[model samples]
Target: MAKAVLLILLSAYVITEMPQASWANRPEEAPKEKVTNLQFYFHDTLSGKNPTAVRVAQAPDSDKSPTLFGATFMVDDPLTETPDPNSRLLGRAQGLYGSSGKQEIGLIMAMSFCFVDGPYKDSTISLVGKNPAMNPVREMPIVGGTGLFRMARGYAIAQTHWLDPTTGDAIVGYNVTVFQ
Candidate 1:
């Protein structure tokens, strides 16, 4: 009886230890898509100011004015670092409106990071926007600095101010897109 029990236990162990061909023979995963370019746009609605006027002349290539995406700014500032380390830029804005009455305006700034989709998916990029703030115009500093900023992987984006609420200016909106 003991011999039979031992034989049964050994068979069980062997079966459990055996590797399955299906698991071991699974196909390899596909390569990930690489992010190559980052595009940005800025717009303002304040009187006498054109937010689209903001330019990044030092960009790697000429800027594209896409009617669909508004105006585009090339992310090619020689001084700006690339592959943003934080993978994001702080968006900030401020405005002053009335000269003789109660001056009032809204402010909004947002930073976003792009990421790849799940496995077996198209190489589409998605952005995560956050840190949006709005308040009455005070004498506070905007929040962050721009120009020649450093990012991850030595990649950088050239940022320019298109509106200043403290000066009673109106800005439309800003857009940033990372290309693969």
Candidate 2:
């Protein structure tokens, strides 16, 4: 009888531990599905300085938050009329803003923006574009004397106006995911 009781207890223990063991043995599940391609509008707040980091906001009313994505400073391409050295081809931009005291001039790739999908909040949407390169130039007039100059610091710039690839109209933001 004692053996029978022990067997029953052991069976329950085994059942209880089985799930954990199975989970441990199995590969970890992928992270929750997130919005992949998101478009953000860019506004050149600094005409002379290159933007380094981008702060994403849920809406035009929301506060801007930092993100992993970035942009670069480049002249607008004459052919495409888009920012040159596109983010799709070059990758994310690198460099620090405010280093030259003068804001950098050029386009940057920004990842910060917020959108709503159904009833769920979708802040995972990232800007899709090419990164830029660092361009060192002499300081401009205003901030130049103060040891400040406009430097292409290689940062992502969010667009204040983005042409929807689908509709081809200027859009502030768009939804990339669906909520349950």
lDDT of 1 at 93: 23
lDDT per residue for candidate 1 within 1-180, as digits (tens), equals 999999999999999999776633655653443444433332333334434123222223222311111222222111111223233332312222111111221122222222222231222222222111232222111122222121222122223334464542332222332222
CA RMSD (A), model 1: 16.1
Determine which window of 10 residues in candidate 1 has minimal summed lDDT: 72-81
Q: What's each prediction's clash count?
A: 18, 26
Tens digits of lDDT, candidate 2, 1-180: 999999999999989877555543555853333222223322222222443233332333222312212322232211111333232221222222221111332323333223233221332223333322123221111110011111212222233234333321221212122211
The 0-to-1 C-alpha lDDT of every candidate, in the order given, reads 0.29, 0.28
Top model by lDDT, which number?
1
lDDT of 2 at 140: 15
Backbone clash total, candidate 2: 26
